[model samples]
Target: MHLAFVAFLVAGISDAVDGFLAKRFGWQTELGAYLDPIADKALLVSIYVALGYYEYLPAWLVIAVVTRDILIVGAIMLSGMINRPVQMHPLPVSKVNTAGQIILAALVLFDQSFGLNLVKLTTITVWVVGLLTVTSACAYLLTWFRHMSAYEADVHSSLKQQKDGSQIKPRHFGQNPRA
Candidate 1:
């Protein structure tokens, strides 16, 4: 438990340092944009799963966290498959959700490592994490649905224009249709 706690702390510190360096040195890249979130998700998901496996965290909370991630990724993939790839921007609620999850995980790890009882605090944190997870998931789903609906409306409008013979035709350079 001590080793696990130390490792978690080191990982968190390293992530923070990496972000600081990237921003301070203008070392950001497109790949980093994608990789950063992936790394964070991987870390948090793994921690939650491990804790739940050891009975340190509730099984339902673990499921909720994992499910939320899966749903978000599935939605993105679905959008791409349908030829309307959605650019993902993290919602505000998601940030708070992640913070709560981290706090809960840390609290559990700290308590276990030091042989300290934090049942009450841990319980409250668990509830907070659960609520944030659900809320964040709903927020993301709502955004995705809205985006897809707008895309559908756009496609319908374009189709209607074509059907009505109201679509504009491109003119060739140095060539006239009337000539």
Candidate 2:
């Protein structure tokens, strides 16, 4: 059981390392896209369940963390249904949420030896961070819808322009240096 947690902790650290390597060396791969979050959830869920068993973290906190992941996954599915790509840009709130979860998890695994009221503080922080995570997830959904709507509108306008004898071509993003 202890070894499982150590492995999970190392995987959690790799989450940061993976992102750094990806951005630094342009080593982004589709496999990393799938594996990164899978590894994150694996580590988080493993630790959460283990800590819950030990009564270090509350069951409800575990639920919140898992539920947030589900909601974001649902958003990704919705975006896919719309034929729009859901890219993972690390939003600040999401980063904060991740950090909060890691802190909370570590506190739980550490058996709350510190006099910082780890359980109470982590529980409160979980709720606050959970709200931010949900909001950012919603923002991603809204951004996807807006992007699709704008694309459709541009297509419609382009068709109209063509019928009206305008010779304008629909411009690709960033194709023109002058905005």
C-alpha lDDT (0 to 100) for residue 176 of candidate 2? 24
Clash-forming residue pairs, model 1: none
Q: lDDT per prediction?
A: 0.86, 0.64
Model 2 residue 147 lDDT score: 51
lDDT of 1 by residue, 24-118 (tens): 99999989989998999999999999999999999999999999999999988888797766766788889999999988988999999997999
Error of 2 at 100 (Å): 1.3
Candidate 1's TM-score = 0.88
Task: Give Cα distance to truth, residue 52, candidate 2, Å.
Answer: 4.4
The list of candidate 1 runs beyond 4 A from truth reads: 158-179
Candidate 1: 10-residue stretch with minimal lDDT = 170-179
User: Candidate 1: what lDDT?
Assistant: 0.86
**After superposing candidate 2, which stretches have Cα over 4 Å from the reference?**
17-26, 49-55, 112-117, 158-179
> What TM-score goes with each of the models?
0.88, 0.65
